[model samples]
Target: MKIVRSKEFLGARAWDAQLIAAMQDATVRLHWTDQPYPWHVNDGQEVFAVLDGEVAMHYREHGRELVAHLGAGDIFYAAEGDAHSAHPLGQARILVIERAGSV
Candidate 1:
Protein backbone atom coordinates (compact mmCIF):
# COMPACT_ATOMS: atom_id res chain seq x y z
CA MET A 1 0.00 0.00 0.00
CA LYS A 2 1.20 3.49 -0.71
CA ILE A 3 0.41 6.50 1.43
CA VAL A 4 -0.04 9.56 -0.73
CA ARG A 5 -0.42 13.09 0.59
CA SER A 6 -2.31 15.51 -1.60
CA LYS A 7 -0.99 18.55 0.22
CA GLU A 8 2.45 17.70 -1.06
CA PHE A 9 1.34 19.09 -4.40
CA LEU A 10 0.75 22.63 -3.16
CA GLY A 11 3.07 25.30 -4.60
CA ALA A 12 4.23 23.10 -7.44
CA ARG A 13 4.03 24.30 -11.04
CA ALA A 14 0.85 24.20 -13.07
CA TRP A 15 0.20 20.77 -14.58
CA ASP A 16 2.62 19.04 -12.24
CA ALA A 17 1.20 15.67 -11.34
CA GLN A 18 1.91 12.56 -9.31
CA LEU A 19 0.79 9.31 -10.76
CA ILE A 20 -1.22 7.39 -8.21
CA ALA A 21 -2.45 4.47 -10.22
CA ALA A 22 -3.00 3.11 -13.69
CA MET A 23 -5.32 0.40 -14.85
CA GLN A 24 -5.87 -0.48 -18.45
CA ASP A 25 -6.03 2.81 -20.32
CA ALA A 26 -7.13 4.84 -17.30
CA THR A 27 -5.01 6.73 -14.75
CA VAL A 28 -5.49 8.55 -11.48
CA ARG A 29 -3.25 11.49 -10.60
CA LEU A 30 -2.75 14.28 -8.11
CA HIS A 31 -2.01 17.66 -9.70
CA TRP A 32 -0.83 21.08 -8.58
CA THR A 33 -1.52 24.22 -10.56
CA ASP A 34 -1.96 27.92 -9.96
CA GLN A 35 -2.17 28.79 -13.62
CA PRO A 36 -5.09 28.29 -15.97
CA TYR A 37 -5.16 25.41 -18.38
CA PRO A 38 -6.15 25.72 -22.00
CA TRP A 39 -9.52 24.41 -23.07
CA HIS A 40 -9.49 20.95 -24.49
CA VAL A 41 -11.70 17.96 -24.98
CA ASN A 42 -11.07 14.69 -23.20
CA ASP A 43 -10.51 11.58 -25.23
CA GLY A 44 -12.42 9.76 -22.51
CA GLN A 45 -14.41 10.67 -19.42
CA GLU A 46 -12.75 12.72 -16.70
CA VAL A 47 -13.29 12.98 -12.97
CA PHE A 48 -11.76 15.99 -11.22
CA ALA A 49 -11.68 16.56 -7.49
CA VAL A 50 -10.43 19.51 -5.54
CA LEU A 51 -8.14 18.49 -2.75
CA ASP A 52 -6.96 21.87 -1.47
CA GLY A 53 -7.68 25.53 -2.17
CA GLU A 54 -10.15 26.76 -4.78
CA VAL A 55 -10.55 26.50 -8.53
CA ALA A 56 -12.66 28.06 -11.24
CA MET A 57 -13.39 25.53 -13.92
CA HIS A 58 -14.32 26.65 -17.42
CA TYR A 59 -16.15 24.38 -19.75
CA ARG A 60 -17.77 24.64 -23.13
CA GLU A 61 -21.18 23.14 -23.58
CA HIS A 62 -23.30 23.56 -26.67
CA GLY A 63 -21.02 26.34 -27.85
CA ARG A 64 -21.53 28.29 -24.64
CA GLU A 65 -18.85 28.92 -22.05
CA LEU A 66 -19.66 28.15 -18.45
CA VAL A 67 -17.85 28.57 -15.17
CA ALA A 68 -17.98 26.49 -12.04
CA HIS A 69 -16.29 27.30 -8.77
CA LEU A 70 -14.75 24.40 -6.98
CA GLY A 71 -13.54 24.62 -3.43
CA ALA A 72 -11.71 21.98 -1.46
CA GLY A 73 -13.62 18.70 -1.58
CA ASP A 74 -15.66 19.73 -4.61
CA ILE A 75 -15.84 17.42 -7.59
CA PHE A 76 -16.28 17.83 -11.33
CA TYR A 77 -16.98 15.23 -13.95
CA ALA A 78 -16.62 15.43 -17.68
CA ALA A 79 -17.99 13.01 -20.19
CA GLU A 80 -16.11 12.16 -23.34
CA GLY A 81 -16.44 15.04 -25.85
CA ASP A 82 -16.71 17.58 -23.04
CA ALA A 83 -14.30 20.46 -23.55
CA HIS A 84 -13.02 22.16 -20.44
CA SER A 85 -10.29 24.10 -18.66
CA ALA A 86 -9.46 24.80 -15.04
CA HIS A 87 -8.23 28.02 -13.46
CA PRO A 88 -7.23 27.90 -9.84
CA LEU A 89 -8.40 30.74 -7.60
CA GLY A 90 -4.88 30.71 -6.31
CA GLN A 91 -2.60 27.77 -5.78
CA ALA A 92 -4.49 24.51 -5.52
CA ARG A 93 -4.02 20.79 -5.44
CA ILE A 94 -6.40 18.55 -7.35
CA LEU A 95 -7.01 14.96 -8.24
CA VAL A 96 -7.71 13.98 -11.83
CA ILE A 97 -8.78 10.66 -13.26
CA GLU A 98 -8.88 10.12 -16.98
CA ARG A 99 -7.62 8.00 -19.82
CA ALA A 100 -3.88 7.54 -19.92
CA GLY A 101 -2.00 9.79 -22.38
CA SER A 102 -4.89 12.28 -22.66
CA VAL A 103 -3.75 15.85 -23.18
Candidate 2:
Protein backbone atom coordinates (compact mmCIF):
# COMPACT_ATOMS: atom_id res chain seq x y z
CA MET A 1 0.00 0.00 0.00
CA LYS A 2 1.08 3.57 -0.67
CA ILE A 3 -0.02 6.99 0.50
CA VAL A 4 -0.62 9.76 -2.00
CA ARG A 5 -0.48 13.38 -1.02
CA SER A 6 -2.98 15.43 -2.94
CA LYS A 7 -3.11 18.76 -1.15
CA GLU A 8 -0.25 21.23 -1.01
CA PHE A 9 1.47 19.21 -3.68
CA LEU A 10 3.89 20.93 -6.00
CA GLY A 11 5.75 19.82 -9.08
CA ALA A 12 8.64 21.11 -11.13
CA ARG A 13 6.61 21.63 -14.26
CA ALA A 14 3.17 21.78 -15.63
CA TRP A 15 1.39 18.49 -16.27
CA ASP A 16 3.68 16.66 -13.92
CA ALA A 17 1.79 13.68 -12.56
CA GLN A 18 1.83 10.70 -10.28
CA LEU A 19 0.18 7.60 -11.62
CA ILE A 20 -1.96 6.02 -8.99
CA ALA A 21 -3.67 3.29 -10.98
CA ALA A 22 -3.87 1.86 -14.43
CA MET A 23 -6.60 -0.45 -15.53
CA GLN A 24 -7.26 -2.14 -18.86
CA ASP A 25 -8.58 1.06 -20.40
CA ALA A 26 -8.68 3.62 -17.64
CA THR A 27 -6.14 5.34 -15.42
CA VAL A 28 -6.06 7.56 -12.38
CA ARG A 29 -3.48 10.33 -12.34
CA LEU A 30 -2.58 13.30 -10.21
CA HIS A 31 -1.02 16.39 -11.74
CA TRP A 32 0.49 19.73 -10.90
CA THR A 33 0.49 22.80 -13.12
CA ASP A 34 0.72 26.55 -13.12
CA GLN A 35 -0.28 27.21 -16.67
CA PRO A 36 -3.36 27.00 -18.76
CA TYR A 37 -4.05 23.91 -20.81
CA PRO A 38 -5.15 24.20 -24.39
CA TRP A 39 -8.79 23.50 -24.89
CA HIS A 40 -9.50 20.03 -26.17
CA VAL A 41 -12.20 17.43 -26.35
CA ASN A 42 -11.78 14.28 -24.37
CA ASP A 43 -12.10 10.89 -26.08
CA GLY A 44 -14.36 9.81 -23.27
CA GLN A 45 -15.54 10.99 -19.87
CA GLU A 46 -13.11 12.68 -17.49
CA VAL A 47 -13.07 13.40 -13.79
CA PHE A 48 -11.03 16.35 -12.55
CA ALA A 49 -10.70 17.10 -8.87
CA VAL A 50 -8.81 19.99 -7.43
CA LEU A 51 -6.63 19.16 -4.45
CA ASP A 52 -4.61 22.32 -4.04
CA GLY A 53 -4.81 26.00 -5.00
CA GLU A 54 -7.34 26.97 -7.65
CA VAL A 55 -8.14 26.57 -11.32
CA ALA A 56 -10.05 28.72 -13.74
CA MET A 57 -11.96 26.21 -15.78
CA HIS A 58 -12.99 27.25 -19.25
CA TYR A 59 -15.43 25.26 -21.28
CA ARG A 60 -17.42 25.65 -24.43
CA GLU A 61 -20.94 24.41 -24.71
CA HIS A 62 -23.25 24.97 -27.69
CA GLY A 63 -20.65 27.35 -29.03
CA ARG A 64 -20.87 29.39 -25.85
CA GLU A 65 -17.79 29.80 -23.72
CA LEU A 66 -18.03 29.72 -19.94
CA VAL A 67 -15.64 29.94 -17.07
CA ALA A 68 -15.82 28.53 -13.58
CA HIS A 69 -13.54 29.35 -10.70
CA LEU A 70 -12.65 26.15 -8.93
CA GLY A 71 -10.91 25.88 -5.58
CA ALA A 72 -9.69 22.99 -3.51
CA GLY A 73 -12.11 20.07 -3.24
CA ASP A 74 -13.99 21.16 -6.34
CA ILE A 75 -14.59 18.62 -9.05
CA PHE A 76 -15.13 19.01 -12.73
CA TYR A 77 -16.72 16.35 -14.87
CA ALA A 78 -16.16 16.40 -18.57
CA ALA A 79 -18.48 14.36 -20.68
CA GLU A 80 -17.48 12.78 -23.96
CA GLY A 81 -16.94 15.35 -26.68
CA ASP A 82 -17.05 18.13 -24.15
CA ALA A 83 -14.46 20.78 -24.92
CA HIS A 84 -12.71 22.29 -21.96
CA SER A 85 -9.53 23.80 -20.60
CA ALA A 86 -7.97 24.63 -17.23
CA HIS A 87 -5.77 27.52 -16.15
CA PRO A 88 -4.19 27.10 -12.80
CA LEU A 89 -4.10 29.97 -10.40
CA GLY A 90 -0.49 30.02 -9.34
CA GLN A 91 0.29 26.41 -8.44
CA ALA A 92 -2.27 23.65 -8.23
CA ARG A 93 -2.61 19.92 -7.97
CA ILE A 94 -5.32 17.97 -9.72
CA LEU A 95 -6.60 14.44 -9.56
CA VAL A 96 -7.66 13.09 -12.90
CA ILE A 97 -9.42 9.88 -13.89
CA GLU A 98 -9.87 9.14 -17.53
CA ARG A 99 -9.10 6.73 -20.34
CA ALA A 100 -5.53 5.61 -20.57
CA GLY A 101 -3.46 7.60 -23.08
CA SER A 102 -6.03 10.37 -23.03
CA VAL A 103 -3.38 12.89 -22.06
Top candidate when judged by lDDT against the true structure: 2
- Runs with alpha carbons beyond 4 Å of true place in candidate 1: 10-12
TM-score between candidate 1 and the true structure:
0.93
Q: On a 0 to 1 TM-score scale, where does candidate 2 land against the true structure? A: 0.93
**Which ten residues in a row are the worst by lDDT in model 1?**
6-15
Pairs that collide in candidate 1 are none
lDDT tens readout by residue for model 1, 1-103: 8889888655446889899999899999999998998889888899999999999999988889999999999999999999999999988889999999987
State the lDDT of candidate 2 residue by residue for 39-83, as single tens digits: 999999999999888999999988999999999999999999999
Global CA lDDT of candidate 2, please?
A: 0.91
Provide the overall lDDT of each model, using Cα atoms, as 2-decimal numbers.
0.91, 0.91
Q: What is the lDDT of candidate 1?
A: 0.91
